[model samples]
Each structure stands twice: as structure tokens, then as C-alpha cells.
Target chain A: MTALLKIDGLRKRFGGNEAVKNVSFEVNPGECVVLAGDNGAGKSTVIKMISGVYQPTDGKVYMNGALLTGKTPEAVRTAGIETIYQDLALADNLDPGLNLYLGREAVKHVLRFPYLDRKKMREDAAKVMLSLGIVVPDPAAPVREMSGGQRQAIAIARAIHWQAGIVIMDEPTAALGVPEQREVMALIERLKKQGVGIILISHNLPDIFAAADRIIVLARGVVAGERRPAETNDEEIVRMMMGATL
Target chain B: MTDNTVNGSNTNTKPGGTSFVRSLLNAWSWLFLILILGFFEIYAQTQTGSTLLFRIYNLQAISIAASQILLLGLGLTLVIVAGHIDLSIAFSTGFAAVVMALIIRTAGADAGWVTVILAMLAGLGAAALVGAVNGWLVAILNVPSFIGTLGTYGIARGAALIVAGGATVSIRNDHTRAFGNGDILGLPVPLVVAAVLTLICHYLLKHTRFGAHTYALGANRASVERAGVNVKKHLILLFILSAFTAGIGGLIYTSRFSAGAANAGEPILLYAVAAVFIGGASLTGGQGTITGTVIGAFIIAVIQFGLVFCGLPPYWQFVAVGLVIIVAVLVDQSKDRLMGGKS
Candidate 1:
């Protein structure tokens, strides 16, 4: 199958330091590719380049055979690549409906003047959340009032509602509880079932082993190795994460 | 991890009693306004042998005072809601007023409606220029809004003074004066303008996509940017909107008083800021409403007018307003805590 996303020899240099060097990967549709690494192993830099937060010094990213390198973060999102940062990046002061459509709000016309179509947005948000199996008791309440899992669900729902072809989650379950973590893992399974491509960045080995179809370990600024979960154990992956020879 | 029970247990854990208290706390500012009005009405009846609330003249005076502060506070409310400040508005108002008055003075006091309209646009443009500078300094240059606006405040104040040649530029336009002071459908023209502007701003802040992004911008700017928003452009527009409203204040100042001093908006700046805070906007941003700001403006106006009507010295108005602002903030903090702590 054609790759849903392809990172062609991605390389990033910050001043004299090479952050991500000669890293390449491809994510096929319906695949969960987890990027695992120790802190400062250039996992973030690689994703940042792919998400358009940072322009690659020498590399290219493609979404469905279209060049995505050098695009602005907003442009990247419009091109169907959604990145859910570790913080969830939610406006805590707004309701789920508003948060779901933060920059691109739904508008209706009254007397030829455009106004927020809040009812439509709210109903749509409700439908999306319900489909995600996330029950928000008060749709009008700000997301800040929600539990951690609910907020995570909202972030995921936002991406899904936008019909994002590729979703990059950075430590999505890091701040969640055990149950919430399970919920998030379940969400990953659902997304995979929907044929959406996912690039998950994580530190938790159990989470990586559980959610990843293929684990790509990063050591320093380069790809250490890649393995199918069925073919590798935590011990070997940990060695690869430590810059061991594949 | 059944999907059916996801977050359902914790969601219902918020007791109804606490939520009731939270709602009441949210309306604390309104309650405070009514309480002050009641106190003033009682004082007018018992001390002055007159009814305060029942008198149209007193109501008109109070509302007119509120209308002035509200004009300045309206756009500032959005700025504050978006987690920024525009201190230069004090002088932006003065600058616009002086520029308008200068144009009118040069065009001749009886320079007809066309000249007056052009002058108003020029005035608004001057204020918007100040706002753009503020946006550039804060948004693009990454200057903290407080410091950036404060710098613009000094620059605008000096510019207004220099433009006015260091004195109030007074004019005598019969049409301008009538528009400033005349009644529209039984409402004072200034009050009418303020009311109409208030409705428009309320709509902009409450019912538009721009407003939604504004709230999101304040709450989490990264969220807005990641969601494909041009945050810099939005910031620039927000500052311009702020200056635009303050410019309207300046235009009214020139027309209503027949003079546009460099310090025209200086005295009202404090009241405008107070109204915003009293309206429940936090310094940290991401919380507030236009309705709350309107009520806040009225609260300040009523206290200022009521104190004088009850024979208190004018300086007492300052002290009283200061005390009320403190109380409002304290109430706001308590409300946040009541709502299970700040988010």
C-alpha cells in the first residue's frame, strides 16, 4: 500500500547542533507508528519538523505524495496533519464546541451578517464526543472543568472531527491516570480501525509495546532501529533506545 | 475501560449545591451593582428627602457618566479578555480627540457635516495607528503587553500634546455640539452612541468567530496557532479594535465638551480599567463577558454620581471606587476557588 506519510531522510540542525540527522520513516494508513526515545534523543525535533513547527535543514515530508516540508503549522493542519501536543493545547476557558472549532468556527448568517452557529457546533461536538464514547455531561462547561481523560478525548475528537488523515500525538497519555491511559489506548485502536495514520511519541515502554504496531527507536539524532512489536521485546528495544547496534 | 462509563463518574461528582453557589458567585458583580444602587437610593430618600432611583434626571446623569467609561472600556474589555492590555488607549483617546478638534478648528467651526465626518475618520485612524504600533511592539517584537502599551502611552501622550501645541484645542461647531449633546429618541446622543456601540461590541465578542478565536487566544495561544489561525494578525486587529473604541471616546470628548485636550482621556482611564476588572475579567485573561463589563461600568458610574448626590466629596468617589475594585477582585478570586480552583 502507498504510505500515508513519508519522511524522506529528515535532518534538522539547530545552530551547530544536529537535532535530527538522516531520519526517514513511513506511516501507512491504519498503522500506529510509535517514536520511542530517551529525553533529548531528537524525537521531538523530528515530529516538530513533520508537524511544520520547524523547517527541516535538509529533508522533506510528504502526505499522500504531496510535499509538506516548509509549510507553516497552520498549513500543515489544513493539509490534514493534526498534532496534539503534550499539553493538549486546549483553551481552558471555552466550551468543547468552541474548543473543537477554535480557529475555524462555524458561522451562520442573520440579515447578511455572519454570527457563530453555536447550536450547530455544539450539536456536532456532542455527536463527535458521543461517537468517541466520551460523555461530556455539560457541553456548555469549559474543558478546564473536565477530567483528564475527557480533555484528552476532546483533543482527539477535535482532530477526528476535522477529518485529519494523519494524527501525531505527543505523550497523549502521559498526564492521564491508569484508567484514562487505557481509555486513550482504546482510542488509538479506534483510530487505527478508522484507517487513520498515527505517529505516537511516548516514553512509557508498556504504552509503546501495547499501542505500537511498529516501534521506531531514536538514539541521539538518528533512527536507532525499527521493529515490529511481535518480533521484539522490551529488553531489545531498551538496548536500541540506548544506542545499541541493531 | 468501558466506553459507556468514561469520565461519567467524575462528571457527576460535582455536587448540585456547589454548582449553585458557583453560579451565584458568577453573578456577584451584578449583585454588587444592585446593592450599591439600593444604598444610594436609600440615602437619597432618607438624607436628601428625594428619590434617587425614581428621578429621570439622576438616571440620565449616571448613565451618561457610564456611557463615557463604557466607550473606553468596551474595546479594552476585549483586549483584557484576550490576555492583553492597552494603556495607550488613555492617550490614544486624547490623541484622536486632539486630532479631530484640530481638524475642526482648521476647517472652521461651521465646517459642515462632510468635514466633521472626515475629521472623525482621521481621528479614528490616528488612534488605530497607535493600536497598530502597540500590536507590532507586543505581538511581533515579543514585548510584554504591559510594557509595550505603557511605552505607547507615553508616545501617544506626547504626540497628542505636540499636535495640540500643548493646550486644549477648543472648537465651536453647532452641528458637532448638537450631535454630542442632543437626544435621540429620548436618549442623550452620547448615551445613544454608547448603547449602540455596546450592542455591536457585544455581538462581536459573543456571536462571531473572531470572538471565539479571541477567547481561545487568551486561554491558550498555542491552541489558536495550531488550529491554523494567524495569531499575529489577530493580535494586531484586536489592538486596532481597542484603539477604535477609545477613539470613539475621544471623538465624543471633542464634541461634547467643545474641546479636545491632550489629557482628555487621562482621568477616565482608571475608571475604564476598573470597569473591566469589576466586570470579572482576570488579569490572567480568558474570562469575562460584555454584559459583565456593561454592568461594571454602571457600577462605577452609579458610585461616582451617587456619592456626590449624597454630599460626599469628589475625592471620596476615588477612594470608594478603589475600594469597590478591590472587592470585585476579591470576589472574583473567591469565585474561582469556589469553582474547584482555577483551571
Candidate 2:
């Protein structure tokens, strides 16, 4: 089958330095692909271009053989590409339901006026959490009241419910405790089984090995190498990321 | 589950009365309570009427004042929530009203409703245009909203003065005057308009994509932009909302006075700002609701009416209002600190 999502010859520049230089990759459906790189690597820049946060200086993005480059963020979302940022992009003051349904609120007719379907939205939010095996006291609870793991889970649920074909998460397990990390790992596995393609940006070798079906390593805005997790060990992967011969 | 540090307090509290209290504190409910108590005491002593009934009786009066403030506050709330302030709403309202009067005279009596509608539209259009300029200056040119709106404050006030010719334009038409004096279901027409506007605004702010986008833009523009939202577009729309609401307020003012004056809305600004701030809206933006603003508007109105009913000097009303505003804000902050920012 054709790649579900493909990036070809992506290059980005800021002032004098090249942030992402002619990187290309493909992710098949239901594949959990990890983009592994160090602090100065161009992983984020590439992801940004793919998610329509920033247009590439030069590149073509294809979603199931359809060109998707240069589209607006809302358009990208409609095309089934969802991105979960490092901060999770949640409204702390709003309840879980409102946050989950943010910008995509459901409307009901009330005497010829459009009123929000708050009850339906709240119910959907609960169902989303329940499907993720996450429990909360109430769907109406403010996100600020939730723990880090719960917040991450809620973000994942948000993307999942939106029916994203490709979900790109930036450090989903960062700052999370071991149990929380485990919870997220399980969620990732579940997404793969559900036929959702995932791009996980991470630095942890153990996590990449544990969760990623394939790994794409980036160095100085270039794809250093690619590997299948079953065939490669941690040392070789680290060497590939660091651009060193061992 | 292994990390107990996540639930160190183990406070799986089901949002008890304390949460309600917290909401009230954030909502500036104490100020309203004090105003009610003071009114009850003074109305009891001065009048031979039932104090309870009198308080209920004054709801119309309070509603009148609250509606005005609510109209202005709704506009300002959007600006504030987007991490900006619009101090020109008072002058904008005044100018809009003055323009309405001019339109009425030009359009003739036969075109009364047309004049009213056009005037309201013109006022809103003018204010929104000005607001768009304000956003452009702030978002594109990098000027602060305080300064931009303050500058527009003078400009709007001058336009009002010019339109009114430094005098109140009194309405002689009985039909037009009826709009101000008429009651609908025991409520003043202005109050009814205000109530409807508030409900619509409450829904818009709580349930629309625009509302969510505004909150996102206010809290963190960079993150919101990264998430693919057009930050500048939302900012412009928010400012437009603020100015348009103020324009609506101008219509109400003209109807209430049966005249349009250049300086009519001068005192309304302080009260509107106070209401938004007192109702848990932060100057820092990303917080506040139309519901909170409605309550805040009524709280201010009740206090003002209470002082007058209590046989206090009119000037003392300002002092009492100022005190309540300061105290309510202090309590709001204290409550936030008490909640340890989890709120």
C-alpha cells in the first residue's frame, strides 16, 4: 500500500541557519515511528512543517497520495492530521469536556438560535476518557485539577476522537512518572492496533525500542539513518543519532 | 499509580460548598452581599414598607444600571481576555448615541425604526473599525492596547462632541420615547435587551469556536499560533465584539435619556471596567465569563442603589463603590492564592 503520510525533500531555513534540510520519510498506516534526535536536531522543525504549524521553505507533504503542503491548520485538521504539542495545548480553566471539544463545539437549535450541545459534549468527553481506561471524578472538572498523566491521556483522547489518521506527539512521556509513562506506552500500542499512524518524537532509547515499530534518526536537519526496532540494538541506534562510527 | 506525589493531598474532594465559596470569591459576591445588607438596614429605617419587598422592588432599577454596565463590560471583557484593554468604550458609546440622534433628524419621523437600526449599525461599524485599527496597531505595530484605546478615547469623545454640538439632542417623538419607557413582562425594555444580549454573549463566549480561540490566543499566543490558529484574526474579531457591544449600549443610553449627549457615557466606563475586573476577569487575560460580568454589573448597581436608598450622600456612593471594588479584587486574589493556583 502507498504510505499513509509522506514527506519529500523538506527544507526549512531561519535567518542564516538551516533548521530542517532536505529530510524525507514515510509512515505506513498503524505504524508507530519514532523520530529520534538530540537537542539541536531538526525533529521539531520537520514535525512543524508536517502539521502545518510552519510552511516548509521547500518540500511536499502527501496524505494518502494527496498533496497537503501549504494548507491552513484547520484544513490540515480536516485532512485527519492531529498534533499534540509539548504543553498539550489544553485550557486549564475550562473543564475536560470543553477543552476536548474546544474550537469544534457542537451546536443545537433553541427557538431558532444555535446553542451549544453541552450535555452531549460532556457525555462524549466521558466516553473518550472511559475508552482510554482513564477515570476522573467528573468530566466537568477543570484540567488544572488533573495530574500530568491524566492530562497527557486527555490530549491523546482528544486526537483519537477527532479520527486523526496521523498523530504526532512531542515528548508525550516527558516529565511523566514511570506509571504514567507506562500508561502512555499502552495507549500508543492501542493506537497502532486501531490502524492510526503515529510519529513519536523522543530521545529515550529504551522508549524508542519499547514502543516504536521503526525509528528515523535525525542529525543537524538531515535524516542520519532508519532502522527496524527488532533488527537494531540501543548502541547502534545511539551511534546513528550521534553520527559516530562504533 | 506508583507515584503518590501526584496525589499528595489526596483531596478527591467533590467540589463542596467551599468550591462554591471560591467561585463567589472569584465572582465578587461579598461586595454584593454587603450592598444588600446595607440597603436592607437603611430601607428598613427610612420607609414604613416591607424591607424584603422593597429589595425585590428595586430589581428593575438595578437591572437598568446592570444592563448598561453589562453591555459595556461584555465588550471590554473580550479585549481583556485577549490580554488587552479597551478604555475607550465609554466615549465610543457616547459617540454612537450622538450619531444615532443625528441620523434620526436627517431620516425624518417616517423612517424612525430605520434610523434607529442604521444608527446602531453605524455606531457599531464605527467602533469596530476603530477597534480593528486598535488591533492592527497592537498586533502588527506592537503598541499596547492601553495606550491605543486611550488615544481612541480622546478621538471618540471629540467625535461625540462634534456630533452633539456640545449639547444634548432631546427626542420629541413619542414612539421613539416609548422604546425607553415601555415595559415588557414587568421589565424595562432596556433591561430586556440587556438580558437577551447577556444570554447570547454567555453562549458565544462559552460554546463557540471563536470563544475557545480567544481564550487560547489570550493565554499563549505563541502556542496557539503553533497549533495552527490565526492569532491576529481572532484578536481583531475580539476587539470588534467589544466595540460593537459598547455601540449597543449607546442605543440604550439614548433611549433612556430621550436625548443623545456627547458626554452621556463618561461615567459608565469606570463601572464597566470595575464589573469585569470584579467578576473574576483578569487584566492578564485568558480568564473571565459573561456570566461573571453580569453578576459583577448587578453587584455594582446594587451597591450604588443601596447607598442612595440608605440616605447617604451621593458622593459617598462613589467612595463605597471604590472600596468594594478594591476589597473584592483583594479577596479574589486571596482566594486564588488559597487554591494554590489549581483553580
Each prediction's TM-score versus the true structure? 0.95, 0.85
Model 2 Cα lDDT, one tens digit per residue, B1-343: 3322223332335457678777766645645666576666667666845453246567778778888888889978877877799888878788878877777656666556767777667766766766777777777777888998898889888878887888887765555677877889988988888888887778778766677667766676754665556677777777777878888888777777778777767898999998887777777677888877887787788777766766677787688779868976787677756564434
Question: Highest lDDT among the candidates is held by which one?
Answer: 1
Top of the candidates by TM-score? 1
Q: List model 1 lDDT by residue over A64-137, tens digit each.
A: 99999989887898899989988998999888998888878899999999999988888889888888887777
Worst 10 residues of 2 chain A by lDDT: A129-138
Give residue B131's lDDT in candidate 1 (0 to 100): 96
lDDT of each: 0.90, 0.78
Interface root-mean-square deviation (Å) of every model: 2.8, 5.2
Tens-place lDDT per residue, model 1, B94-158, is 99999999999999966999999999999999999999999999889999999999999999999
DockQ of 1: 0.59
Candidate 1, pairs of clashing residues:
none
Computed on C-alphas against the true complex, the DockQ of each candidate is 0.59, 0.21
